[model samples]
Target chain A: MSGFSRFTPLVNALPSTIPFVGPEAIERQRDVRVKARIGANESGFGPAPSVLEAIGRTAGETWMYNDPENFELREALALHHGVSRDNIAIGGGIDGLLGEIVRLVVEPGTPVVTSLGGYPTFNYHVNGHGGRLVTVPYVDDREDLEGLLEAARREDAPLVYFANPDNPMGSWWDAESIVAFARALPDRSLLILDEAYCETAPAGSTPSMDALIGQPNVLRMRTFSKAYGLAGARVGYAIGTIGNAQAFDKIRNHFGMARISTAAALAALRDQEYLRDVVGRIAAARERVAAIATENGLRPLPSATNFVAIDCGRDGTHARAIVDGLMEHGVFIRMPGAAPLNRCIRVSVGPEAEMDLFAQALPKVLSAVR
Target chain B: MSGFSRFTPLVNALPSTIPFVGPEAIERQRDVRVKARIGANESGFGPAPSVLEAIGRTAGETWMYNDPENFELREALALHHGVSRDNIAIGGGIDGLLGEIVRLVVEPGTPVVTSLGGYPTFNYHVNGHGGRLVTVPYVDDREDLEGLLEAARREDAPLVYFANPDNPMGSWWDAESIVAFARALPDRSLLILDEAYCETAPAGSTPSMDALIGQPNVLRMRTFSKAYGLAGARVGYAIGTIGNAQAFDKIRNHFGMARISTAAALAALRDQEYLRDVVGRIAAARERVAAIATENGLRPLPSATNFVAIDCGRDGTHARAIVDGLMEHGVFIRMPGAAPLNRCIRVSVGPEAEMDLFAQALPKVLSAVR
Candidate 1:
């Protein structure tokens, strides 16, 4: 247990904890091979054939480090968003970018605002930096936008996080409401408007890029992990004003990008037709999940993202039993960590085979849990 | 130019800078294609065929995020190095791990020590964390061990960085000397023993894992970017005491690793024969580069790494001219940034074709410069 005795006091005080336990670890711990991997909100339908081709073609070039500037990907993203390359900053993933954004703003004892149970990874980053968390609880299963704004104003918090088409509950706010919320925040408050599930959201749910591109206090995080089906590739970008974007350059690991991953992202970006087709599949899978939940005597929440949160009609313990029971049948799924929200189990959209497995396992798991 | 107004003063004071200009950036800025990519010290021999196969096979799994724990890779590495899995921490690469390490140890005004012209990326991380750098100049192009020790003790610095078989100058100390330096440092002074180039170094040059694995003050970094020929894969690991290793989990983006890159690293690790073969090729290419330097009447510094630094018989201006002139011929190479070292241009090992291009371009560039 001997360790480096000179780590900063902040680091020493922090616990070695993972924000989410990966499905692989679950499989290992449960001693059961995951027959249906519908957890973690990963796109089991997979990336486009063109993206796989690009990855294969770029395999030979893996000896060379990726361009540190990420020029090509940024240029493509800029063109796609109708902004300059300076408006975009690429990172390992949204998770990685969240850590950087937190580091840029949070100091010891700094107050930061987010939903009570929203995005544990962001909360992890905040706590890691010694920032005090000021959480606004979800209202009607959606992030309490007004409460977040109030907390930011009252605490004069420098940072706030809001996820569009949010995880766990799979809830969303309309583009107009989101824009209004951003504009209402204090000038000193930097809002991380996480749109990780944007591509899968219903039309008009995601705000237009131009709406907040000029706002220095707002950053929109989008990822290739969801609709593009490349979560494993670790490609995510933040869009903001030029100065806010450049702030990432001040502290990011310049040579940290994986070359093949970049190629995969570029190809994924270019093949929008495939993305469109995959989005269709994801929506259909969501419906299938809802049907399965309803048939199993659970209430499936309305979703704008690629997952459906099923209310198990009980408390967190009952929901946890369902989650653990599903795993026993080799069907892996996750649940929210906070009260009320934790009364439900979260299941991601996957291929029909996985959905079928979930359908088959749910009744049996529920019976056992009951 | 407007940015989020609430960034910490440390971030505001920092410049948006890259430690090294990538070759791709040079090509974009200068409007030239690199015919011979010999810059950045990346292995041009490429990763093993088995690794390419692994990548292709794993490409379908890119939709899923990599395991947060990186359990399999750690297990394999632990087996390879004769250490327990708890002794290792995985990261995006050495570059990403350095940033994490600095965050764990450094805070505003914290004093950290390193060679004056050592790895610029490490310096960038130190600066990003607001750590005050205490530098000791290289003695005869080798990182001065005694000078670094003295500076750490004088400053009572908590962190020190030492790169063995060092970069830019490609000099090395024997294992005994390295171990002695590590043992002499005070308990509170944490040492980052960067061994990124260890695989290409001469046998017996790298200390055995058991020699320093038990030391709480030392963490040795190794990478797939060099002799493993997977720079683009962005996989690096740090070896230290179990508690020191777990420290990374406190703040690292747990799911940041690219799944394909992890597979590639695992495959590369399993194919020891490919590594052996590539190491031989790298050593041979190093010799060829030195011969080319000698043929052109430049003094090639003796190197144990995968690159050679050639003294140009003049100052920084002359060396810059040679570097720029070679780039005009589509041959991309780099030189050190500081005095004395700037008199040397560093070239990475590559395939025979790239070597031939460099061989052909050197004399013409030299003649033009002269």
Candidate 2:
């Protein structure tokens, strides 16, 4: 446990832990292989064939450093979103971007606001920067916009996190309500509007690109990880005003991007036809997941993302037992960590073979846990 | 210039800037095409064919996130370096790891030490974390180890960076000297022994992996970007004690690695035959570059790296003109930033075609600049 004695007090205070243990780690830790890898919200359907081809073509170019400005990718993203290229700042992924944004805004003991059990990675970053977390509990299993606003006002927090089509619970707010929340928040409290799951949301549930682009205090996070099926590519971007985007230049690892990842994202963006088809497939898989949960006498909550949360009609222990038992059968799935939300076990959508394994395993897990 | 009004005071005071202008940016800014891309110290010979094949095979798995633990890759690297997996920490590149280290050790006004004309990206990260820089002047065009040791003691610096077979000047100290310097430093001053160019250094130059492995405060950084010729893959690692490696988990983006990039690194590491071959090519190219510079009446410094630094017989302004003049002919090269070092124009070793372009253009460009 010995470490460099000179680490800043803030880093010293933080725990060495991953926000989420990947399925690969689970396999190693449990001494069992995960056959059905429908756990990490990755697109088991995979990226467009064109994206793979793009990666293949770019392999020779891997000897060269990627363009530090990320100019070409930003240009393509801007055109896709109808924003100026200056409004886009790319990073390794939303997780990496969250770290940078926290560094820019949070100092020791600074107040930051988020849902009590929201994305743990963001919370990790805030805690790493020595920020005091002002948590607003999720209301009825959805991120409570009103509660968040109240906490931000009361604490006068400088940073607020709100994710549309949220993870873990897979709930969302309408485009109008999200826009209202962003507009009504105090301008001094910069908002990180995480739309990482917005691509899989029901139509009109996510705001248009133009909705918050002009708001200097609101930075929207989007990724090619989920709907684009390039999770391993590590490509995500933040959309904001030019000034906010430029601010990333002050602290970001300017040449940190992987060349093939950028090419994969660009190709994925260009192949919108494949994205539309895959999104439909994702929607169908979500339905299949919910149907399986219902058949097992569990209540599957409505989901706007590529996953479903099934209520086990008990407390966290029962949910935990079900999760552990399912993993015993190589049917990997996750559950929420905090109360009320932890009453449900979360399963991400995947190919039907994996769904069949989950369906076959869930009944036995439920009975054994009971 | 509208931005989030609540950025930390340090962020508000810092200017948004890229540490280095990439060749792509220079091409765009100068409104010319880069036909001979020999700048940035990237290897133009490219990675091994086996590495490319690994990337092709790994393309299908891009849907899944890379293992957050980075277990398989870590095991491979540990075996390669004759260390335990706990002794290594992987990052996006050396650039990204530098940022994380700065964050861990630096707070506002924390004095950090490095050579005055050293890597700009390291300086950028230190400043980003609000660490005040204490630069030791290079003695006889080499990083002054005694001066750096003195500065660390005087400033009580928590961090100090020393690169072997250095960039911008291609200078180095013998391994025994470097080891002695490390052992003599205050244990409180963490040493970042950057050996990014070590793979190409002459025999007996680089200290063995075990030399300082037991030292808690010394972390040695190595990259596949240089001699392995995988600059765009963004794979770098730090070799240190178990404590220092695990400390990265307290804050690093756990899933930030691109799957294909890891595959490439693993494959490239396995192909040491190719590495030996390319190192030979790099040496020959360096000779060619030095010869071209000498023939043009410039003084080419002795280099143990994949690049040569040629003194242009004047100050920085004269060297800058030679660099710009070469760019006009699409022969892209760079120059050091600080005075004394700025009298040299740095040129990376490349394929003969690029060297041919540099050889063909250097004389004409020099005449024009003169």
Candidate 3:
């Protein structure tokens, strides 16, 4: 267990805690293969066929480094969003970008704001940089925008994170409220507006790109990992002002991107028709999940995302048992980490076959847990 | 150009700079196709056919996120290196790992020691993390171990970087000197023994895995980018004590790895015979590159890497002219970023056709520069 003893005090004080235990880890630990992979909010329906073809065609070019500037990918992203490429910064995924964002703004003991039970990965990065966390609990299972703003101003915090169509709880705020919240934040506080689940959110739930493009304090994160079904591709981008985007260049691993993944993203963007078609499928699947939850005597939250949160009618332990019990049947799902939220179990949309597995297992798990 | 006005003072002071300009960018900027494609030190020979087959087959699974634990790949690498899986920490590439290492130990204004003409990307990471650099110049084209040690102790720098079979110069020190240098460092000073080229070095040039395993202050980095011919795959790992390796779990993008790339690394590791064969080709290409340099009346430095550095007879201007001149003929190559290292033009080992093009283009470019 000997480690370099001279690691910066911040690094030395941090514990090794992963944000999520991947389903694969569960398979290995429990010696059970997952049949319904729905826990991570990945698009179980997969990316378009054209993307797979692109990866196959580009496999031979795997020896050359990807363009560090990511010119083509950024241009495509910009074109899709009607913004300039200079306003885009690409990284391995939103997770990677979050780390960079945290590093750029957080000095030791700097107060950063986020909702309690928000993205653990962001909190991990903030803590890794020795930034003090000042969290506002979710209001009615939705991120408390007003509370977050109050905390940021009170603490004079330089960074705040807001996620629309939030994870775990599957709740969302209207676009106008979100825009108002962004405009009301102090210019001193940088806002990381994570729209990772926006593709699957209900209409009007996400602000238009133009609404926040001019705000230097706002960086909206988008990823191909969710509805695009390329979670394994590890492609994500942040849309911000040109100068804020360029800040990433100061410290990012210029050659860190995988060439084929870039190709996959390019292909994914080109196949927007497939994206539209899959978004429909995702909506249908979410309804199916909701229906299953309703039949199981659980209260399914109204969702603006690919996942639905089912109130398990008990404490955290009850939700935990149901999550573990479903996993025993190879039907994998997850629950929120912190209290009140943990009373619900989260289920992601998948194909009918996986949905059937979840349907069959949920009733049995509820019965067993009860 | 608007950016958040409240970024930490350290971030505001940093400039936007990339360590390396990729060849694709060169093609776009210079309005020319890279026919020879020997720039950036990427292997033009490409990955093995078997690895390509693996990527094609696994491309269908692009929907699932890579294992956050990287269990399978780490186990395979562990077996290959004859160490426990806990001894390895996976990263995007050596460049990515360097950034992480710098972040783990460096704070604002922290002093870091490295060779003056060493990898610009590593220095870029140190600066990105707000560390002040303390550079030791190369002696006889090799990184000065004594000077580095002296600087580290004098400045009480917590981090020092040394690359065996160094880049831009293709020079190396013997195993005995490397081991002695690692052991001589104060326990508080962490040595980054970058062995990115170890697979292609002379048999005794690299210390054995067990040589410095007991040193808590050392971490050796290896990559699949060079001899494994998977530069675009973005797979690299660090070898160190269990505790040191686990420390990465505290902050790394656990799910940032692309699934197909992990498959590519596993296949490449399992097919070491292919790697052995490719290393042979790389060595042959090095010799071919050296002969080409000699034919053009330049002195080719001895290389243990998949690239050769040819010292131009004049100054940095002469080297720059040759690099730019060769590009005019569709022969893409690069040179060191600073003098006296900038007096040399670097040519990465590639397929026979590319070498033929380099052989043809060099004399013409050299003559034109003259």
How many residue pairs clash (N, CA or C atoms closer than 3 angstroms) in each of the candidate models, in the order given?
A: 0, 0, 0
> Which pairs of residues clash in candidate 1, taking residues 3 or more apart in a chain or in different chains?
none
Interface root mean square deviation of every model, in Å?
0.8, 1.0, 0.9
lDDT of 1 by residue, B1-370 (tens): 7999989999989976779999999999999999999988988889899999999899999999999999999999999999999999999889989999999999999999999878999999999999999999999999999999999999999999999999989999999999999999999899999999999899889999989999999999999999999999999999999999999999899999999999999999999999999999998999999999999999999998999999999999999999999999999999998888999999999999999999999999999999
Off by over 4 Å in 1: none
Output the chain A TM-score of model 1. Answer: 0.99
- Rank all candidate structures by their lDDT, best first, as comma-separated numbers: 1, 2, 3
Model 3, span B247-366: residue lDDT tens? 888878999999999999999898888888988999999999998888878899999998999999778898899999999999999898877898999999999999999898888877
lDDT of each: 0.94, 0.92, 0.91
lDDT, model 3: 0.91
* 1 against 2, candidate with superior lDDT: 1
TM-score of 2: 0.99
Q: Tens-digit lDDT track for model 2 on B258-343?
A: 99999999999999999999999999999999889888888999999999999998999999999999999999999998988999
What tens digits encode model 2's per-residue C-alpha lDDT throughout A168-232? 89999999999999999999899999989888998999889889889988999999999999999
- In the range A1-370, model 3's lDDT, one tens digit per residue, is 8898888888878887878999999999999989999998988899999999999899999998899999999999999999999999999889999998998898889999998998888998898888999999998999999999999999999999988889889899999999999999999999999999998888898999999999999999999998889999999999999989998888788998999999999999999999999999998998999899989899999888888899988889999999999999999899999888999999989999999999999888888988
DockQ of each: 0.91, 0.86, 0.87
Candidate 1 C-alpha lDDT tens digits along A1-370: 7999888899999987779999899888879999999889998999999999999899999999999999999999999989999999999899989999999999999999999889999999999999999999999999999999999999999999999989879999999999999999999999999999999999999999989998999999999999999999999999999999999998988898999999999999999999999999999999999999998889999999889999998999999999999999899899999998999999999998999999999999999989
Candidate 3 segments whose C-alpha is farther than 4 A from its true place: none
Error of 2 at A17 (Å): 2.5
Which residue pairs show collisions in model 3? none
